[model samples]
Target chain A: MSLAASQAAFQAWLQQADDAGIAPTLADPRGLSVYQNNYRVSLMACLSEAFPHTLAWLGAEAFEGAAARHVDAHPPRSFTLDAYPQGFVETLRAIW
Target chain B: MPSPHFGPHFGLGLRKPHYADFLGGDVAVDFVPVDFVPVDFVPVDFVEVISENFMVPGGRPRDILRRVRADYPVALHGVSLSVGSASGLDADYLRALRALVDDVEPAFVSDHLCWTRLGAFQSHDLLPLPYTAEALALVCAHVDAAQMALGRQMLIENPSSYVSFAEDEMTEWEFLGELVARTGCGLLLDVNNIHVSAHNHSFDPAAYLAAIPFDAVRQIHLAGHTARTIEGREMLIDTHDQPVPDPVWRLFAEAITRAPHAWTMIERDDNIPELAELLAELDIARDIAHQAAADHQVPA
Candidate 1:
């Protein structure tokens, strides 16, 4: 695969855990799990930070569940992670 | 105003919890939000801010940054440069950053060597790049483009990575050395990142430090990391949530011994403690750098 394709495959795996994006191309895909974890954990941390008051109200378990759902629904499309929280309140509204 | 040249300065990442300590007035002594504190309260040579935070139209954050810059030399560190992207550098992002640089006149502008964006999707996390000749050329071109846009040379920081690609050509250090040679950019050597990447990839941390272009290094980042067991194997993550661990401190001693002139700072994003705690951590860094300088007979 080309460089762009390689990165796209990596991004695909990171966002969707679709190893088929790289299962054929990669020699060892064991580390992709780490990247996936980093992606989710970072976005989750962003949500937890951006909505601290909400987290305090919902508690860690509920807040993390909502954050994971939001993360799965929205793969950050902005250059800054600060923008990722723009529509997060709607996620909470929809869930609650 | 005198130009801000990078010296062997000790500093910390300006987090929200410590804003009062940084911008001093008659604020509360505890971690409660306050209007301000004393200007010279934190006691550091410089302060580093996330460039994207102030990369906005006039706001309270910009005002606060300006106030802080009046007291300390500010360093603009970015996360979304994505210089390693195969697509190219984002023009709009560069323009926004250049505006901030023009406003701040910071001590330095630095971003990670890894890519965080591709096409419309911005990962917001430092992702690894294949150490291939093609990637090296692309990164050089992007760095050149970024420097031209900013009207100054930017410092490229080494990122901690969990994956090593199959199409790798040279080592990460070799890629960085070549990048510096091609783009005339300086280096921000994150010692904690080196330790994390070294353990995750099973490479010798000393070897990585030795291969670094010490003369080109302008800053050093000391941060904490977390250890997690993935698939029954241990892996280190650059979480930056806690204090700088001892192993990273040892490697930093060696790193400072080599790159004595680099401005060093500690970065703590999540679970940020009080300003005094970070200042005390900065003291440890000061001690290490002093010992290293004294041992090497280099000016501290």
Candidate 2:
């Protein structure tokens, strides 16, 4: 699969509430779901790491929700996930 | 020197919640407790380490350092050193880092060889730099200056990159060897990172391990990584959100045999489980090391 196609597939996988039709009998959807949650969790952590002042400004719950949504929309183009939420301040500005 | 608290000298990332427990409880971790002492917290171990978080001035950073430095060796793990960038080092930032190093009297200080900025734009991520001669020269100069300013050696850690640079020269390990030669700095080899970078870049993991000087390695970092096959091209992402994976465990086993006395630690930056959970993982690592040592006695 091309990079774009696979990226879209993962995007679709992430968008699905439970990844309904994926990951057959070998691994449960629960494992995939947990992995999905962690993908978001790690991105939020990067948000907190990069924008601690933003986190302090928005508070944890709201900041987390916004960060997850932001990542969902902007998916990282770079290989490194270190700055997944590097544009968060601007994203927060656009949203709030 | 063997850490008084821990017998074997391997530790896990001391997250915030467990800080109070670690400081209050009598038990200590590893021979050298490679842990972080966050801003606005009391001192815990014989050493108070910082994550370059509170390595600033006139704010909670300095205040926290003042309180923690009363006890413990202060080692700084910085995320912004960008020792692999072609744009050259940030002198101002380095100067501040040097000042902080002096104040802490840290046992050692380190940063990733990944560039976090392009020009004036700072992404705040430990982004990977191209493995080229230009990149190597820029990083070596910074390492040399950082060592001179701090009046001590600086250890450079490998970065986990998702994509390979279009322009490159030599392997990452070769660049590391060259840097050591040019600057006389040490290495904080991240085992999981070796696995991650090798997976992403499609290189021989064993070959990468063999290239670096084992003696120069002062520390080892083991963290979790996530894998997702994006359109058939698999990508392994380093996400320090869970327990160390099994593959990393195997790789870590190989590492300890080579760098036997190297100080190692598990890094969990998010979704941090209970201290018991981390300790349990640490217990596994300890057990593996013991078994490995025991096997050597049988004469392989």
Q: TM-score: which candidate is best? A: 1
Q: Evaluated with DockQ, which candidate comes out highest? A: 1
Candidate 1 residue-wise lDDT at A42: 84
Which DockQ values do the candidates obtain, in the order shown? 0.62, 0.06
Every candidate's chain B TM-score: 0.94, 0.83
User: What does the lDDT come to for candidate 2?
Assistant: 0.65
Angstrom error at residue B146, model 2:
1.5
If scored against the real structure, what TM-score would every candidate get? 0.92, 0.69
List candidate 2 stretches off by more than 4 Å: A1-96, B1-8, B25-50, B58-72, B296-300
Question: Candidate 1 DockQ score?
Answer: 0.62
Q: List the candidate 1 regions with Cα displacement exceeding 4 Å.
A: A23-28, A52-65, A92-96, B1-6, B25-39
lDDT of 2 by residue, B167-272 (tens): 5667899999999888888888888889987887778888988898876777778789888775456777777877888888988887777666666777887788
Q: How well is each residue in B250-288 modelled by candidate 1, as lDDT tens digits?
A: 999998888777889999988897777888999999999
Predicted candidate 2 versus true structure: per-residue lDDT over A1-96, tens digit per residue: 222232233335554543433333111223344345545665667778788887898899988888877876675543245446667767888889
Query: Which residue pairs come into collision in candidate 2?
Result: A6-B231, B3-B31, B6-B30, B6-B31, B9-B31, B46-B72, B47-B72, B47-B73
- Residue range with the least summed lDDT across 10 consecutive positions in model 2 chain A: A22-31
